[model samples]
Structures are given as structure tokens and as C-alpha cells.
Target: MWPTVSPQSRSSPSADGAAILRLEQLTRTFAVGDQFVRALDGVDLQVAAGEYISLMGPSGSGKSTLLNILGLLDRPTSGEYWLAGEQTSTMSDDRLADTRQREIGFVFQFFHLIHRMTAVENVELPMMLAGVPPAERRARAREVLQRMGLEARINHRSSQLSGGERQRVAIARAVVMQPKILLADEPTGNLDSVSGGEVIRIVEALHEEGLTLIVVTHDQALGSRAHRRLLMRDGRIVQDVSG
Candidate 1:
């Protein structure tokens, strides 16, 4: 069963009512053997605070490229990306790193916990990197782990935990910093049906608690769960629908 998160325990949506992220004529191109290939072409998107969205497309359709740019992991070839009303394209590398660390969290298809680290340690890693005090980091790590229903496994190494447990730890780690935007890429691709269902429920719960959730997935069922769905093809968004 999924754990229930109290509203008080979650971060509230942006109070001033601004779009959390916006992309204006975004484009990304990579040189493959002296030939430029456009991965994203003139993409425009606006994500409001607390919106739940899904990006779906076939292979090489630019889904990953778009996500990377949104997460501040990649830069657009020639376009503007605004985050929290700030133009990110002009920010220095340090500013981008700080913004990415503070505003966005990510979960990938493969659980990326260090095998030698305990669940709590994995969760504490981010806070530690940000120079958080040791006591606060430990407390916050345990708190989020407990929320993920992994209290008992908090001290266990990643290698000692089951797939579901490890994924839960990863989720705990991702949100431990309380990022406003959570980007998930094939979050359930590595899990069985039961584990995947549980993971889905957990992320949905976070979305309900006011995190801006954006998911990139191939599963139609998973993609359909978003309130807004985007379909991409040939380096451009072909369809966008909201219900």
C-alpha cells in the first residue's frame, strides 16, 4: 500500500501564480559525423506551477533532448528557456547548476543509487553536497525515507534492497531537497507491474501535494495519467491535449 502524505509536509505551489517553466522556439542540434541533426526543433512550451504533464514519442523523437534542456542538463542550440521568470540561457554554469539543484529533481528508468551507500546515505547525498548540516541532513533523509514506506530499510545498502525498495530510496533521494519540479524518465521501466504501480502511486501523490510533475514515458497507460499530454515526432511536438 502507498503511504499518505499530509499536505503540511509538502511544499506549496508558487504563491505568485507564475509559469514554473517556459520554452520559446527551443531548438537543439548535434553534429553526428560532421552532419548536424536536429533533436528538437522550434519547440515552445509553458509549464505552470503544479501541473502534471507527460511527454510521449517514438525513439529519436526528441523527448530526451527536451527533458534534458528543461532540467538544465543541456543547452538549446538557439532559443530561450525561462525558469521562474529568469532567462536560463544566459546564466553561467554555476548559476545553472545551483538552479537545477534547487528547483528540479529527477528520477530515471534505472535506479541510480550507489551500491555501497545505505538508503539514508543516498538520500542525504544531495543535501550534503549543498553543505547542509549533518544533523539536518540525516533527519531529512530519514523523514523522506519513512514517508516512502522504507523506514525499515533506511540503514540497508542499495544492493541489499529489492527493486521496489531501491526505487523508493531513489524517489526519496530525488525529493529530499523538496524541488518544485520533478522530472521522471521511464520511472517504472525497470520494475514489475506491482512495483511499478506502487511507484506510480507515490509520484501521483507528490503531484497532488503540489509538485510540478513532468513525465517522459513510452507506456500509453502511464502517459494517459497526466492531465496534459504531449506527443512528439521528428523533433517537434505534434500534439498537445489537456483535460
Candidate 2:
């Protein structure tokens, strides 16, 4: 069962009116040359707080486009997006950026850590950008890294870590801000099975800790960990299954 998180108090809105994120007739289109491609069309979706969902699709499916819109990284072409009870369809760029920074955490197919920075420092990027005080930032970063089993690797730069280690660092950084939702785009796509499983465990642990997680992946095994799965094809969601 999902929590009754009103739009004001939760990160991801729930479906069945328990939503933390809501989309009605969501659409996204791109103009390429003289042709228009509909990446997403008439999509209606809702994600409640703390639900772990996987968005799955084939190569040309609209999974990435949907994730972008849900993460506030892109806007819909002709629909309404209600995030945390607030209408975001018409927010200014700056306002959307600020809200996104505050409410969404993102992980990608490749670990995007700064090679020059140590693990702890990398995880502190969000806090740093949010103007959190230096002392608090350091402490919070340390706490989250340590929780992610990176206490010993905290001082290691990305160049010095293994793929699994790097992914862990990225996860730490993504969750450090306690965003309402974590958007992972093919997060385990670049890792080996062992490393990939490790990364998935880290993400699942976060989801268990009450974070709403949406993973966009082509890997069915990886996507199965989520509580729900949304399957996409040809710019539409064809199926939604629950575990």
C-alpha cells in the first residue's frame, strides 16, 4: 500500500490520488529538419511517494523522454505536470531549475563523478550548490558516503576507483540531498553483472528508505527490482505492471 502523501509533503506523488508527481495528457515532440517526432503522446501518469518504478522500453521507445519530463529536466509539449502539488507546467526556467535541484536526484548510465575530486567531495556537490554551510556539507557527505559503504573510499578520486566504486559514489551524491525522487537513466548499463548488481542494491536500499525511484532501463532483470514497471513503445506506455 502507498502512503497518503499530499502534494505538499511528499516527493513523488502516488497514483490513486496519492501522487507525488502527476501528468495528464503529457506530450513531448521534437522538430527535426522538416519532420516532427512525437517522443511522448497523451501520457497520463502518477507516482506516489516511496514507490520504486522502472520505465522499460526498446531503443526508440519514449522511456528517456518520459524520465526527462518526470525529472523536470524537460517540459511537456501539451500537457499538465503537477509536482509536489504545485503546477510546474508554466514555471520559469530558473524556478524549475531550483525546484528540480531541490526535489530530484539523478543517476546516469555512466558514472558522472568528477575525476579530480575525491569521493566525499563529489557527494558534496549538491549541498555545495545549495549553499549548505561547509561544515554541514562535509558532515552530511561523510554520513551518506559512509552509509553507502564508501567510508574508506571517501578520499579516493574517481580515477582511482573501480567501476562499482564509482557507481556507489554517484549514488551517494544523488541521494545526499534527500530529493523526493531518484531518476536513474540506464544507470547500470555500463557495469558488469557483479558491479551492476551492487549498484542496484545501493539504489534499492535507498528506495527502501522511502525515496521514490524511477529507473529507465532496457535491462529487464534490473528493472524487475522495482515495485512497479511501466513499459513503453512508439511514444506510448503500453503496459504498467506491479510486483
lDDT per model vs. reference: 0.89, 0.86
Q: Note each model's CA RMSD in angstroms.
A: 3.6, 3.5
**Residue-level lDDT for 240 in candidate 1:** 91
List candidate 1 segments past 4 Å from native. 1-17
TM-score of 1: 0.93
lDDT of 1 by residue, 118-159 (tens): 999999999998999999899999999999999999999999
**lDDT agreement of model 2 with the native:** 0.86
lDDT of residue 48 for candidate 2: 79
Clashes of each: 0, 11
Residue 153's lDDT in candidate 2: 92
